[model samples]
Target: MTITLLGVVGSPSPGGRSFAAARALLDGAAAAGATADVLELADRPDPEAIQRAIEDADGIVFATPTYRARSSSLVKGVLENTGRGVAGDTRAPLLGKATAIVHTGATAHHFLAVDDLRDVLGGFFAAQVLSPGLYFEGADYVDADGIPTLTDRARELAEAHGRAFAEFTAAVRAAPAVRALRPLL
Candidate 1:
């Protein structure tokens, strides 16, 4: 099955690290035979369009830069708005869908930002949260233009994560037995 992956970049800065990492992850997914699309939160997002994208996607990758030890407001806004639709339903629209997160910061101390995202995604939306969210620190991979360039190891990890998420999404969509057990609320 062809999996649709949505990469949401929440950084307010254009071409920031989080956005670049998201693109890299998407590229990896594309190489694995999955269809991937990008949505920039700073581009004046439309709630309807965001909802449509989320509903259509089989997997989602949320990427953001650490700001005050939390995710960017833009990213939070998009997720909060989307969560409203699935609030009380046993089977949320995002439930059973594979999801991953990526965060970037200037220091290793900012690793907690991923946990902040996890708390929101896992607590509110019921998304299948993947472990070990990719966290990049320092400027080793960042370019003068503020884009991220993954090293060989980083690329390998990103590709593995993408492939895993894609496979999980496919299996979840294909197995009726699994689907029957999923909580709809």
Candidate 2:
């Protein structure tokens, strides 16, 4: 199955660490045979446009720069607005799609944001969130080349998540779609 992976980078400013991380992660997804694209939300985003992108994607890589102690408010707004739109349209727009979270923070403590996101995406969006979300603390700064080169460990983890996410999305695509939350027969 050919899968399209969409990376949405949510940074309050352009060229932030998380923006670069998202770009790097998209490269990893493309390397793993996914058709990858990205939407960097630095400008004023239209809610309808965000909803359309989320609806059309086969898989999503949600990357954000941590703010205070959480993912960027910009990212949260996108999710909240898109989630509300899709839920009203149908119970789950991402019923079988996969989503992976990547965050860049000031310290390892920022990694906690991934768990918060996983719950929101899985419980609210009905996304099959891939395991072992990625986080890079402080190291990756976007250079003049606009590349977000990750540390050895972070690079390995990002590539692994990409490969795993692609495989999982393909698997889910092949399976039958579930129409409702019926009890197991």
Candidate 3:
């Protein structure tokens, strides 16, 4: 079974840290034999396109740079709009699907941003939010090509997160309920 991993970059600045981190995660997923697609929010402003992508994806990886200790408006807009559709359904469109978050900031102080995203995504959308959200202290860890030069510990963390996401998606797809939902997708 093929798993679609969609990465949504929520940084307004072109080729910013958030975008780099999102690309790294996508590359990691792809290297692991998962099909991955990336949506740069700066390039795609239409909510319909984003919602369609979300609906079509098997798992979502949301990446954002900390803006005032919260997600960027672009990210929030995508979530708020798409989330509205799945609000009432116990089986949210994103429900039972794997979700991983990545956030970057100039300082380690912005770490709370990931927790905030996890809380909202878990409570509102019912996604299986993966733990240990990837946090980058600075953009230097990721080069211009979007390759992450992670330290041993960081690389291990990222790899573990990627594997967990892949495994969760595989398990979800194997479930009877998810199998029933596949026809509709």
CA lDDT, every model vs. true structure = 0.76, 0.73, 0.74
Q: Model 1, 57-171: lDDT tens per residue?
A: 9888999988888888888888766652443643255655667899888888888889878867766665667787888776437364545676667667777777776777677
Displacement of residue 160 (Cα, Å) in model 2 is: 2.1
Sort by TM-score, top down from the best: 1, 2, 3
**lDDT at 114, model 2:** 87
Q: How well does each candidate superpose onto the true structure, as a TM-score?
A: 0.85, 0.84, 0.81
The lDDT ranking, best first, is: 1, 3, 2
| Tens digits of per-residue lDDT for model 3, 136-172 | 7763464535644554555566656776777776676
Residue 27 local lDDT, model 1: 79
Residue lDDT tens for model 2, 1-185:
67888888898777677766777677777788988877888876677877777777788889998777687888888866653224245424555567889988888877788888887877776677887788888764434576556766767677777888788777766665632322111
Return the top candidate by TM-score: 1
Q: What are the clashing pairs of model 1? A: 89-185, 90-184, 90-185, 91-184, 91-185
Scored by Cα lDDT, where does model 3 land? Answer: 0.74
Candidate 1, RMSD to the unseen true structure: 2.8
| Most lDDT-accurate candidate | 1
